[model samples]
Target: MLAVAAGCGGGGTGADHSTMNRRDGSASPGAAGHNDADVMFAQMMIPHHRQAIAMTDLVLSRASSERVRSIATQIAGAQNPEIRTMSGWLRSWGEKVPAAGAKAGGMDMADGMMSDADLAKLKAARGERFDALFARMMIAHHDGAIAMARDEQSDGRDPDAKRLAGQIVRSQTAEVRTLRGIAGGR
Candidate 1:
């Protein structure tokens, strides 16, 4: 359920909205003076972060790289609170949080969510290999999140949601760079 009524504080970088995004991946009239984009952003990002947290948990249980664990710690710290913030948006919006019933969909819309199998593999890996896998998987996941945030910035109308989306883009983009550095031993 997307809370449609919450206001936002200033956060993150601004988005580039040269075009509008619709669920169909085509341009629309930009939520047409509604907070649909905020709802959508919250709804989509929840599941995305959930998967990320799950992946982080996997590495933390078995990782040998202090750097990898540290990165995972940071990612979890940033995203977990974001989930709460978005949940607040849904509550304030008076929208039902997604999947209030099975009829409602979940955050399946986020970019590169890991599967149980991927998690299993990570659990089975060791040492630098675990770090490598975590970095690679997280990079993909962040890229997906970046795409979704871009969409929200372009098509979302709520000022706060747009602001959050921009923040997500900047923060996750920097994280992606950091992960790449980890991958390259920088």
Candidate 2:
């Protein structure tokens, strides 16, 4: 019994402790849950969504048009939950969520994000000008999201991840049209 207990102790040889299955039922070490596609999608997307939300918040604070503010609120609201959902996926997969400041630093659509200068410019504008800028910038941001979503849809193997990407594409495409109309350019 002592030998058995000792064997089960610090240097246990029954099984590899390093490759144990997690409580969340992700997978054993030898198995893959999501994949690099899922990891890349989530990692790249979180900050992209964050930037969109930041833009939306800027307009929500000083937007003159009820329509624009309403749209900004909606965009922020929808994307916030999606960010949490994607983060949850990363957590379940035992992956790290990328920081907002982390450079996506890749050839992906996330690289097309707005510069700090652009955000500063947005923060400085107001009234019809602000509406115009917000519409134009958000249109571009939505386009970037659509591009990323399309990539995920094409490459992602996970069913839920692909479905969410499709949702982002459809919803953001519609929003692009709506924002363009609001910008008086449609």
Candidate 3:
């Protein structure tokens, strides 16, 4: 199901230790090779990504056009693996990873996470309404991710985590452009 957008180019599970991520899941807490910025990036982005995945799942069936569904698939393909990768980093760092697949909540709207009411509205939308709302919300969501990735690039100490942050910026920034087009420049 997540492989639906295999060719769309959302980064991977940080499998390439040579470049994107150097830390392995087996590394002990003392050997995590990460700083607080890396930990915060993993902790925050994991749930952020989960929320995006949840939205994609909802949109796939209800989207009026094939294009929207395709984007949803792309997002899931990219993010689901990244979530696993981040969770692995957290575990290696001896941090408490949020429960797997936790729905987005509690984060302030300024952080770009949708509130319960927003999710409920999205859940209740249909046809073109869903498409428009999704484009708007996802663009906002992607912007949030880009911001966090930028923070990691600035404050994170691990080369692997910084590489992953760069990947996130590139991918999600592109997604924001596409989503803007989908939103008719709104």
The 0-to-1 C-alpha lDDT of every candidate, in the order given, reads 0.66, 0.67, 0.70
Task: Work out the TM-score per prediction.
Answer: 0.74, 0.78, 0.82
* Cα lDDT over the full model 3: 0.70
lDDT of 2 by residue, 1-186 (tens): 000000000111222222222334354565423555656777777878888888887886678898899889888878887777777667767678777667555534344478788889999998888998899888877777777777777665555666777788777888888999988844
Model 3, range 1-186, lDDT digits (tens) per residue?
A: 111010111222332222123344565333325666676677778888888888998986677866678888888889888888887766766677878667434355555688879989999998888988998999888877787787777776656677788888888888888788777834
Off by over 4 Å in 1: 1-34, 99-110
Best by lDDT: 3
Q: Model 1 reaches what TM-score against the true structure? A: 0.74
110 in model 1: Cα distance from truth in Å? 8.1
Of 2 and 3, the candidate ranking higher by lDDT: 3
For model 3 the local lDDT of residue 127 reads 85
Clashing pairs in 1: 1-96, 1-97, 1-98, 2-90, 3-89, 3-90, 3-93, 4-93, 5-93
Give the clashing pairs for model 2: none
lDDT-based ranking, best first?
A: 3, 2, 1
